[model samples]
Target: MAVSTASPTGSFGPPPPTTAGAIVVEGLRKRYGSDGPEAVKGIDFSVAQGEIFGLLGPNGAGKTTTIGVITTRVRPTGGRVLVDGLDVTQDQVAVKLRLAIVPQRPNLDRSLSALENLTFHAAYFGFSRKARRERALELLEQVGLAGREDDRVDQYSGGMAQRLIIARALIHRPQILILDEPTTGLDPQSRLFLWDTMRDLQSRGTTLILTTHDMAEADQLCDRIAIVDHGEVIALDTPRGLRKLLPSEQGVEVVVVAAGDAGTGTGDPLEAVRSTPGVERADVVAEAEGRTTVRAYGAVDAGDLVDRLKRAGLELVELRQLEGSLEDVFVHLTGRELR
Candidate 1:
């Protein structure tokens, strides 16, 4: 169904065929009240056509608010959002018709059966009875819920319910799909199931915008990720590209017998580690069972680190490369982990 008419800033016309990208945000900003804190502080980014873009950030970082604005559920206090070159403020109805949103929480009717919910949502898009039935059945089978169509939504498992929600969102065959924390609380099996569904959609040339706290999920699915913190894009790159931002880009964990064993009796182990070849920085990260675990960052050389440890009279209990990851980059840039 069409959304409420928008003000003059929005448009009622169709988009041109040669738009540069699927979605673009220029200096987007949002604040609750006259004196309220700015939830989004003028962030800019863009999603290419048929690309899976991710928004990764901690809670209250304005990820949800940004999605809400692009989906036209919330209005921006400043800046502009364009979907298919259609300004969100000026083309509310046209933009709404082009995109579908699967929110963080499922909003299906508890009283309605799965089939009922899909068909009901289809009706809002002006589908005929026969069309709704065909569309509902097709989506049900596509989402692997063909046999559970008559069951009440409340009876479905968390994963099953989420699948139904996705099916409902696709009832109108939107060009863009926005998923907010789509796999936040699913079991491994369910998570993988939903991932396959998402991959299928992308293969069919659907543009996807995703927001999630799961770094691994983002790494696995997103073609590029924008890390937002305090309403800013702190980092924007592919998973591998983001990992390269970490200092040292490579690391190794060394377990020493004692702090003093890795240096002079009164010297600092961290200092000794830093002085080692290829060791950019080293810090004692853990202590347990009379052993000290030091993580050395940089392009760590195992042989060099081991030789240095031996020269300091330190016994190397273990040495292994520490893989860099998106999470490392997130913590590095945000100064705090995703809560």
Candidate 2:
């Protein structure tokens, strides 16, 4: 379970002469202006056909700029990107035809009904009138907007508009779909619905490249993930593989209610756990509702840790063993929580 870390010179060299990947980026770099900062710096990764690849990073980590280059919206300051073997810079039109983008914000035609939106998008791809209508209806039904096809998109709820946007993106059936923070503003139920929709699209042979801050979403959907930070790829692996980057594969979450008295000798529960035997590392992951939740990693003896806390006058509210998580990996790599 060794996780691979990418270095600018070695691991991220040029891609192979020929690749079956749906999208390939090599030595990608971008800077805003003559004196401005570099946004993306020599990044490399590939997304296979029919694979759900995730790009994860905190804001300002250059993932957005990298995605901009991939979608052919931003001209790269260096390196090259290929979609289906066509250079994004040289084959803009051809590359665009094979890719569809679902932006984080809903950008459906506000003046048009949901059905008209889909039909118009398909028509732009040169579908026949009959084909446009049939395709629009099918997509509308598939996105659970069948009964609301005639309603103007501006009147739709956030989730509904998002669904319409997804339907519109699929109208032309592009070979690759780029979803930028697809479920960002969605409620839990709406988010789950979209997750299912994405899965369905994948089942139908669509390759998806997702950029999301939600570690759970990346863990659930991506076949592989590339974690970009400070304009470089820090780590790339499957969710499980990334978890292996932690000091230990096993961890324990302990929630303790602190005693109110000022004289309580528990200097810092987190530090205590760190000094405890068999514990490799410990972090205070959360503190709220008058409870402190500490996550300890390594060959931790949960019973021993709890007993030590009790000895120090800490009321143990909950204790649970945990599988190392993607969030842990992110923190381990960047030393910052994902925003």
Candidate 3:
């Protein structure tokens, strides 16, 4: 039997010791109206302190709704969400004090300078005039905006604007940082730079909860990931751990070379291979130079596949095993790839 990865284990009672986790969500749920569709069904998970935990799923999978509940932006129909030991419902003010959220979109005031934006945000936390300026300068330097402190935010590039927003979120020194699609439209270089910034924050002991549809981003950054679908958590585990849950631990790729004028003549060699015993799934990934490349998943017997190909009057050009990946596990669990 194939093994299944379950959600993070925990109880729904009051908050645990601070060392247990930075965020505890028990039976978290939300619905737009009394009869409206349930955006977030009953779900539970925990984010350990100082760890970069990821909520990974396609659009409308409840990633954003769950974050809404944790940040107290959307009220939950039923659940217990504790941020740094304070319940989000009863301790909203206290919860807000311990966490900072960087939304999916840029919310900076384009009219204000980068320094001015951070300065105003710090003021809300009650920093004095002198203190706010000092903190803003320090943060600008930290986010690599030291020289651009006085530049208007409207003039900043997308990456620079994102960095400033992150700096603004840190003005009050939040213990937990929540980012929703932190690099949605960033270029490759920008995305890599942002990843470096995330690593730096983790090194400083800031627990991060980020939502992303980018599989590579989640695999590269998160210590643990929760694959949510249809408003429920389908699987949760470390990247390496999740990859192990695939129904087919091994993959096989085969290239067929048909003889003579029979070249590339195939009614469906891919489907024929899928019907073979022990083959979980098969797809024709490519075709070129009178050859068809087939990707087969599962504990496929290479010898048996080669024999079947021979019986089908096809010649074997090449064969190899494919490495397991998280995308395979995700498709197996969710029944669909990320959109």
Candidate 4:
């Protein structure tokens, strides 16, 4: 295990009364549409101290359902949610104050400028006008949105709008922050920028729980990740530990060099690669324009397989071994690509 790391723990605000272990959920369950169809069917997990917890899954995998229940946005069919040791259902008001959620969709007021968006959010949290302004400015600057503070949300780019949403979430300095698919559909640059912002927030002792289908995002940010698939957590561990479960597979992706729509190469490369040494499986295949490419699963050091292909004279023009990643484990467990 690569022993995950996160924000500082063990320091508190003055005595035995300060917050500890920001969020906790036990035997969480929720279902919709009746007895036959279940959204979340009895899952249990915990976020410790100041660590970043990742809730990962495909679309409609009970991630949003679990989050909604924990954040008090929706009532659960069963199971109790607690924040800072307070039952969410019983101490709804207190729990609400200590939590902040950045929704997957933008809810910013179009009429308000970026700064005004944040200010209005703080006002909803009941911050005084002056305090709201101070907090809004500080948060905007922290998220790299200070320069465009006066621009209306409609005028802002997708990245900019996302940044503003984060600032809005922080308006009250909540004990825990929840981000639901914070960077989906973002350009690469914007995605990286948001990741940096997430790191900054973690460094400042903000415990974060994020829901993302992006393996890279979960691997890079989560202290530990729980892989959700079809309404169940298929696996849970540190990113490295999760990959170790699949034994560090060397993924092979080939882009063929071809001249025409039809050509022959050993009948079928997919079948050939499946029989190669150290190969666990080979699933992805595409044939177009005299080219045949495949995505294969194999343990590290599959050079022998390459040598075998060379001996068989399979015109292998391109080959690169991708290092094992969380995506590999996800595929191994769920039998589907994360994307």
lDDT of 3 by residue, 240-315 (tens): 8898787566678989877555444453568657867788788898999878999888878888888777766678
TM-score of 2: 0.75
Candidate 4 all-Cα RMSD = 8.2
For candidate 2, the C-alpha RMSD (Å) to the true structure equals 10.1
lDDT of 1 at 232: 84
Model 1 lDDT per residue over 1-339, tens place: 111111122222123224758999999999989899999999999999889999999899999999989999889999999999899999898898788888899899999999999999888777778878877887788778889999999999998999899888887777788999999889998788777767777786778999998988999999999999998888899988898788765788888775453445423456557778877778899989977788988887788777677776677788877767888888888885445
Clashes of 3: 0
Q: Which residue pairs collide, candidate 3?
A: none
For 214-272, candidate 4 gives per-residue lDDT tens digits of 99899999999988877677788888778767754656765443333324445456666
Q: Candidate order by TM-score, highest to lowest? A: 1, 2, 3, 4
- Supply the TM-score for candidate 1: 0.76
- Considering TM-score, which of the candidate structures 3 and 4 is the better prediction for this target? 3
Model 1, residue 32: displacement in angstroms? 0.6
Cα displacement (angstroms), candidate 3, residue 292, comes to: 17
Q: How far in Å is the alpha carbon of 19 misplaced in model 3? A: 4.3
True-vs-predicted CA distance for residue 253, candidate 4, Å: 17
Question: In model 4, where do residues sit more than 4 Å from their true spots?
Answer: 1-19, 33-36, 247-323, 337-339
